[model samples]
Target: MAKRDIPEINAGSMADIAFLLLIFFLVTTTMDKDQAYIRNIPKKVEIKTEIIEVEQRNVLAIKANNQNQLMVRGEIIADPDKISEKIIEFYNTNRNVNDLTNDFPTYTHPTKNEIEANLKAAEKELESFEEQDAGDALIDYAYSKIDEWDKMKRSLKLFGGNDFPLINSQANIRIEVQTRTQYSLFAKIQTEIEEAIFELRDTEAKRIFGESYGVIKTRYISDEEPIDKGKLDLLDVLYPARIIEVTPKN
Candidate 1:
């Protein structure tokens, strides 16, 4: 019988071949997904139409006086609970706004000056409206807006002279959702505030102030009906819990 020879494999370059194959796979492999919050961004000023891109959010804050009258966003909320519902729905306390801006849609203009002018005008108009309705049952609510604006400036301010956050993303955690959703949330908040104010007013109105204009107004302090801080705290906790995002689904 012919001698059977066993074939020997090359071992000298095996390590190098294995290393090359590992490198090749590593370069071609996809990385694991980064866990991050998603967002929907809006366009910039130039291409933005008359219904301009208003990056905004729904936020609520409650402030009440000794009268047990709740104020949301500044206006007296007659129903603290209702106002809370609206706020809770819109409030993302930890929302990272800087990221939101970076992902926002861009609107290009023929010239930088044009976009600047438009942005300025829009800002002015928004401010004017804010001032006009400043105290319209929403004095306490000012804190949230100022906080938001500060967040906006600090986040967009970094992008040259844009009046937003200092970051390039122009991302705001403010949660700029659909107009209808925004309006609906605001309305709920507003209604709650109004209800709180109404209750306070009713308490006062029920009591007759002195005939003279300068006399002090008073409520009949009854032991059973006496208001307490705990009451307010409880109300605050309970009301905001009911907030729901109400938008029609297709």
Candidate 2:
């Protein structure tokens, strides 16, 4: 009997408000993460690379002339097949110590056999987990190495340690021209080199049962003229793409 002062309920308005909020959120939310890929633009000045520390032969530099024929260092690679062989040999020798992590803490020094045993155990565990493909593992491992290399570069730049665009996979390789006198020639060589690397990465990931990883184009810092090659030493190698003029070292 006391329902005389009851206020009118706004059910329709409440529903409309809820619907509008939902639409607002749906419009604003980002479903997929966006990542920025940096591209270094070349410059027109005397580039001072100052790269004294030589990278371990992990990166196979394939030099090409106007033609895309691959050259290992300076020598013309007679057999293209041998390039992979050389890289594999380098990886076998230059890979980080097997002891990057001490999997077996109990043993101070595990012999080769003992290491094999550990690997077997890992395989057994993987099987039990029904992990049919170990592709993600390879991708993760490759990314970490690449990240480390990026960190190293930032340190050497005398800047606060920052992760720059770096490809660290032993899989990382290089393609260059002997001289920057001809821009068109080097551009062609760069394209061919990228395609070759893309195919190789595809094949290896398929073979190793690892997730596919693509080698992205490295960024260049500035734009430089082909003929303006000013004292371009091996320091240019540190920069994966485009010639850059760093301020003269103090």
Candidate 3:
């Protein structure tokens, strides 16, 4: 019997081929980005300030329960898509004229003269605080008041009208969710709120600046232009998203 010789298989290029395939996949494959909602966490208060009561008309309450059911302003919403419409209505209902009979937030139209007078007063208070060497807390409070008045002045200038309309200071959108509520529903609520606010601001931006809110925001982010920043500030002042998220209770 003749013994057969076994041939050796060559694997010298196997590593190189695998490396090439890895590189190809790495270069050609696309990854999905994680979506997230960015929100500012309120600063912790060291002092116990007096709690001011918010009127029912000024609060837009959105609630979600363990069953994922949604309720807005005491009305149950079957379709999540309608949430945005409700939000839009809440803002637009009393935007131009106030009707005390209606259960919606009221608008305040502050004239330029009024804004200027308040700004001057704020400046004087700030100066007095500085001269008196007031504590940091009081001085900071004065500075904040001055900043608020200055912001109002800029907002009024950009508004380009006899008066700048502002929503009630106490107006806010509050979101309350149960501990077992689905994250998807919570995210949907946030999305609806964001969509409603964006639509309002975009409409106003187009009317005032002849540009879209998204475009102005993108440009401001990229270039940091003062004009675009002012436009954004005015738009924000017109449709501020004062949102409060309540902690889910067990």
Clashes of each: 44, 13, 0
lDDT of 3 at 193: 96
Residue runs of model 2 more than 4 Å from their true location after superposition? 1-52, 64-70, 77-172, 178-184, 207-250
Tens-place lDDT digits, model 2, residues 43-141:
344546576653443345656554546676456776555555544333333222333332111112223344345455554555544455546554454
Best by lDDT: 3
**Candidate 3 residue runs with Cα over 4 Å from true position:** 1-30, 128-134
lDDT of 2 at 152: 39
- Give candidate 3's TM-score: 0.85
Model 3, position 204, has a per-residue lDDT of 92
Model 1 off-target regions past 4 Å?
A: 29-32, 38-250
Residues 138-165, candidate 3, lDDT per residue (tens digit)? 8889988888788878988878878977
Candidate with more favorable, higher lDDT: 1 or 2: 2
Worst 10 residues of 3 by lDDT: 36-45
lDDT per residue (tens digit) for residues 72-170 in model 1 = 445655754665344433332322342333323232212334445545655665577677886543443454445444333332322234331112122
Give the lDDT ranking, best first: 3, 2, 1
Top candidate on TM-score is 3
lDDT of each: 0.39, 0.42, 0.92
